[model samples]
Target: MDSFKHMHEWRQNIDRFFGESFWNEFDSILKPNIPQINIYRKDYEILCVINIPGIQQIKQIRCEIDGYHLRLQGEIELPAKGYELIQEEIIQGSFNRAIELPYRCREDKVHARYEHGLVFVKLYKDVHDSNKSKTISIEEGEQ
Candidate 1:
């Protein structure tokens, strides 16, 4: 049909204009490329739990919170002498994950703990009032 051909041509033109990036982003958002996260909502706070295995050391991971987004960037080094794997599905290499957090966290109260090869970060809901105020002790003639 001529109408079907016109629709196909229009679709191709749109795709050509946007390139593959538009589709890729749409795919990423439609079906996120990361592991699933579980949200536990209590009366006062929202908790996000991610199952990140094989990640050790809280210091090795970098966490940054900006507005509603929280990002975690880190590396998990594989063992040097693991037997030649025929089939490997475990995800390796450095991963950078950006998660949109449901609630604001206290920037100073964000804490991380590692146990059983999993890294867990607890973000508190309330920002500490003390963190907002900066005390500058001006020493006489120190400048």
Candidate 2:
């Protein structure tokens, strides 16, 4: 029968290529690739915005604050050869994002910036000391 129909179509193409690479690495580890944030509150100050995209310089981005959390580390560089990544929901390498400061901020008056690719933080709302918490100072911003 023609070599058993070419071994059943090569075992159905090796089970559809390992079932699409095991659901694309189980949906990128249950979904979590960082980059994509937006905190509100304006006036007393408490804004944040992140959306880094394949950063190449700018010290690979890095910020930190402690009074309710506000950390962000970066690294999204991947594409050194003839591209071909069909569909990848942004997220290339090392990334760590954190934001949680409804109040209690003023780690030395935080303020960051990083145009275009986005990353404009600005916290300063101790509002008469809401149980202060320190750990700041991460400059380098503007344009």
- Give the alpha carbon lDDT tens digit for every residue of 28-141 in model 2: 477775877888887888888778876666677777777778878778776657877788777677778667778777777776777767777888777565544454433445
Estimate the lDDT of model 1.
0.57
Give a tens-digit lDDT track for model 1, residues 43-128. 54555555555554555566665545567667766575668867755556676877777766555555455555554555667543
Question: Clashes per prediction?
Answer: 0, 0
Candidate 1: segments with Cα more than 4 A from true spot: 1-18, 25-36, 80-82, 126-143
TM-score of each: 0.59, 0.29
